[model samples]
Target: MAALMTQFHVSPSGDDSAPGTEEHPFATLPRAQRAARESVGAVLVHLRAGTHVLTEPWELTAEDSGRDGARVIYQAYGYGTDAAEQVVISGGTEITGWREHEGRWVAEVGALDTRQLSVDGQRAERAGIDGLPDGTTRTETGYRTTSLAPQQWQAPASVEFVYRGIYPWTEARCGVAAVTHTGEHTEITMAQPAFDQAKALYNYEFEYQRLTGPALPTRVENDPSFLTTPGTFALTRSHPDHHVLHYLPRSGEHPSHTRVVAPALETLLRVTAARDISFRGLIFADATWLRPNRSQGFLHYHGSGYYEGGDIYTEVLIEGRQWLTVPTETATIPACLTLEHTAGITFEGCRFTRLGGTALGATAGVGLTVRGCDFDTLAASAITLTGDRDAVLEDNLIQHIGLDYAGSPGISLLGTAGCTVAHNQVTDVPHCGIVAGPGTGTVLSNNHTDRTMGVLADGGGLYIAGPQGDSFDNGALVRGNVIDNTRTPYNFGLYTDYGAAWVQVQDNVVGQADNSAVLHVGPPLDHVVFRGNYWNSDPVGSDAVPAGVTYENNTTLTDTDELEAASSAIRARAGLLRTQEPAIG
Candidate 1:
């Protein structure tokens, strides 16, 4: 007869006029969400532990739901304490007066504007450069390069520029607005229409979209004479109410005992249209994104690079030549814990780290349930999920993350329904480790991908882009996964791209891939279907296996004791079979 639930606690040193119980807790988290919206039936709210910082976002709507069959948790008294009892919900802004200047260190931060910085908790490194110099053209409003002497830098409108070429699967960025040198050329001005609609969404040179790399920006970053690396960091505003940051210490760092951290709110949690909520073992950290630092500049184009209005304009024709291109549900990057149109939500064992964006974002949900979570580093994609329904991402543990978006991907999902990415453990990524766009009854089972495309090339370890339902019993199902490595070089261990339709690739296991056709299937695909998989070569053994596909009886392990007895049961049924602890009190 245990039908009584209504507990509230919250802390960071209690007192929002206490009495939210647990020996009078309730300090913030909106006064324990206004006493759990005036408690009625079921409700939990706990919280406790340390840092709750947040300078904004913490919203929840549908009047913070929990009607019929009540259930509105918000846990974190989790994992029997210890380890400093984690629970951080930070949006950053720690800084503290440092002062040093000559060899770097600075500080101040008041008029703040961030692009991420962490230091003592690691994750710093922004001064950047990495290429872009040889006759850099492209200019109607930006880019001319005669080689950075941009009028002796102080702040070329906060520099930025960084790109990943004309879609080796996109990663763009913008933000500089006026540099002017004109004579030996150096122009630079950008930050408008995000580098003019990211070169009109395809980096000029259309018609087969040529230009696959530098036409200008191969990378650049904030100013201060590009800081000449050493654990980097830059950022400046000078006056208009001050802002300065600096940093350069990386030899036992000691800016008055470093702990740093920057990131000033790019949404630190918002869940609208809520219903039976539930968020256990909390830890949504830092947070970044400021629309590529204003002027809507972050026009990335593919996969999770959802170009922010999802770029359009097509024209195709091919061999008959008529090309113009640009497609697919663009504009991704926006997930620092934002769940919209929620339903019976449930995010257990949560712990999204660092996060400069793309870390736990649910959209138009219904019966969502992300289990055993713990995505790391993150700068993009460690779970995006869009237009959900009956969703259920299982046993999670996506690692490293795209750091600062290189066409990021470790679970991107889109338009799902009856979704279910199981037994997860996507690793180190830079792109594709479970993508899926346009879904329906998807079920990528027993997951496990190692080393992911690392620095992106042509995405790998499970992709799928178009049509996902209307066959294999209502489509999509690439089972028992375990793809060991794809670290670069046009990867794939199951891709299916663009015209992909009604999927089904079974019993997966591709221990190592640099692609000689580790299964990509496209040239405009359709009905797809590969069966009984287990690679080591022979995904059509050297390409040429297209045509709405269908291959059967797969298995190409050229003996190493039959590939270690069939990859030891797919590395023992792939990752985290259990582990989601918390709640000891």
Candidate 2:
């Protein structure tokens, strides 16, 4: 006979040698998982109210999957009760032992390789350039500056230069190779030039011109001289095996009283090829991620260069000249929660906060759902779902994401089919809000996005693209979304670019966009239908609304009262679920 359903318990004060019962719980999730692996049928692991520090990933592989209509659930102990408590699963190490040094606080963290630090549950700033450089002149190779002394630029080779070009939308980070002085100018050569200068198109607009050229105005960071501001920190290695943190504490904040932490692990949970697993009511926090520096290149395909009506197509070129643009690099950055080749996995009512990389990621999964979760203060993208089938991301609140990396979106869906992205509020992101591409049967509805593309350019609140030949016969539906406050120079509220076809966009309210309210660009803009959309601002310079587009029932609001009413109604219907409530029955 098969074993009966099993229940395992984990707590911070429990012992691993216990029987994993309500009274005697295991100490860690991995120990409970080990006990669950030895059992059969259904298994549920209850995590009590406490902090669980993860020194390594809590991996759930295929062998640990539930069988025969059973599921493996990891949830809070009192999940549905009023007494439900907070369960924190952290991937960082708390630091103690502070001393004063020259009006600053210093701590010895001992070989922790991280760039992110948190104090009292707030993300502290990394030391960066205080202001703009003194002077920047374009060079044949890279750029020359008269900003700092030669010794001030002699940071380690790992230091990078973040440059904001002539356009607000154009930015790049390149590694420094050597910093030397030529006459009166300090010449800095990059390991790899941000972009090829020879391939730049000179006669294009300023926005397009920066995309094809070399670096513009630049600011170098991570130098020791910039570590003067309060709540800013720098990590220095004085010995081969020891690392120290130099911190400028804020007023009334001291190391002895503050809960200071630095990220130690890259991933908190790794579900690999598992099935019938669910994680709910848990907090995942404080994981580090380093962006890999590889041979990255961009390709700018000028439509005027090819044909008469071809628009400028700028994409991250990977290998060939086939006009294929890859999504933001995912294989290099680590995430807090990674689900790879997993099926029947769900994350409900969970919290992912203060993470250094992407918060949640799923690759090649089926029957995946991320519902009623909160993703905040993330360094990279909030959520990325790729090559998944029948995926649903709904009723989630994502804010303050993409704080460090500007290339990623708040939510990105690539090669995902039959997916529903609805009722989610995504705000205060640096790049796009909801980016769905190269997919079919995707329904994006009732999602509110605000203040997106705030720091970067050339994106939108709702951005969609596809391959050249796919017909989108499944008919992607983008309806009832509220896109507001897209303030970047070239960012649109709703953008369909590069062969997006056979999609219906309806009933969305777009307000206060820098670019057009709805923009259609690139080639093969076939069978895109826009209906019943309310534009709160004038769409003045949009010319890519092709002749065959099915544009009908769209309205432009001139009255303030009507625009405010429409915007308020849309927000009320598409608002975020900040607290736990009953799921839609």
Candidate 3:
């Protein structure tokens, strides 16, 4: 006979003082977690349908783990009957008591400081202006603009300078310290160290472009002077008592009618040293991070890698080409949900949306499985796995990610072994779709990518680079995947770059990309094989195989009938097996 499991309940309207039964469930997750910690064997914590707003992160540790191979499951108790019924664990506070001031609605948010705001479940644009005015030049402090008056703005110190062109793949952001008017030239001084540090990082540019410094800024944000347009919001914190929020109504929006949410917490969940935990059919939403708003702002070096204080660079040889690589000790845009030193964790059929950072991050964990999830409208990457063993990411719908940070990939796995990323639909991404960095026995298969590498350079649909074990001896395998479209200018469909070796690409399809050059190769590449693949257009990388790369049995379809028949099977087997449930692989 199977062992019986203990169950507890929690709800948005529940009371913590109750008996914690179904009829009298706990009002908060922490209360229910406290109750679960007192139990043994298998346990289930059922979160009823409603929004559970949190004051801090809902955390679980080893003390809350299950025993004897039993699992502690946190799931949605009842959701199938009503499509609108949901279990939302949010890190935002609602804004209310709106009144009209001049032409727009105004609210006195007591002391909330946030970088992201959402109105009616959709992300609202923080007030911004495009670039410095015409006669602007970079100064020792920040900039000198003759057209825009910085001294007269309501919040002088809160304006953010967001810049691109640090490289083709880097976007740097910093906060303004002070603004002053110097006769005809307005001086905007930025926060120290990070501002000067970004200039040094930009000096180490990509090999193609040996540029000087990053441009002044593509845009500037969070100034009340730039809030003239509709559908925009601005915050003025220069007041003595409270920070004021001014929101201009869109064509059909009213602050009193629509819901406005400003995210307050950076992390929604933090699990450490836990085992045998699962989250099912839940929603993790509306979390934001504000570390980038600090003086030491975000300085991105490459994908999933940012330089905080080091200007370190090392030269490496790839396929006879010499290139510079930097240290990626830590990543920028920390995940709203972080799991460290945990094992036997699974998140199934969950939704991660409207988040300001990465959805999920797991490191130093074994047997982590993320399946059948929907990730949308994120500012950073969808999923990131680092130093985890035997992790599986399958059958997830990842779309519209990297909305703010364009260099983040859809899925990134680094420094791992015995991992599988398969049957996931990664679409509408701004950078690479799937990236494998410095791992062994990693299989990236049956996945589908569409319209990837749309904004950044030096990326591809499936960018498999770095050390991938011994040459084809249970090494990394890239097979049965489909690359639908990569319409960007300087990217590829299948990329073997950065001295990646001992990898195999078999039985895949590349369609509707830059058909003239579907494949991309970077030097120091060794012992890589590409065979039994179908392309809609002829790829030009075959002309010169160089020395270590080999191409065999790769077909280019000129005939319509043969192309249609061959591509049908490869496309059918790609992406999710089913929407309701992920098929076991």
Q: Which candidate number would show the highest lDDT if scored against the true structure?
A: 3
What is candidate 2's lDDT per residue for 177-224, written digit by digit as tens?
Answer: 567777777876655433332223212233233233444535555555
TM-scores vs. true structure, each candidate = 0.38, 0.86, 0.93
lDDT of 1 by residue, 120-234 (tens): 7778878877646777777677768777666677877777878774567777888887787777777777877676666666633345456522356677888878888788888
C-alpha lDDT of residue 351 in model 1: 85
Which window of 10 residues has the lowest lDDT sum in candidate 3? Answer: 515-524
Can you write out model 3's per-residue Cα lDDT over 387-496, one digit (the tens) per residue?
99999999999999987788899999988889999999999998889999988899999999999988877677888887799858757999999887786777667777
Residue 368 in candidate 2 has what lDDT? 92
Better of 1 and 3 by lDDT: 3
lDDT of 2: 0.74
Best by TM-score: 3
What is the number of residue pairs that collide in model 2?
1
Instruction: Select the stronger candidate by TM-score from 1 and 3.
Output: 3
What lDDT score is found at residue 78 in candidate 2? 86
Q: How far is candidate 3 from the true structure (C-alpha RMSD, Å)?
A: 3.0
Give each model's whole-structure lDDT.
0.78, 0.74, 0.82
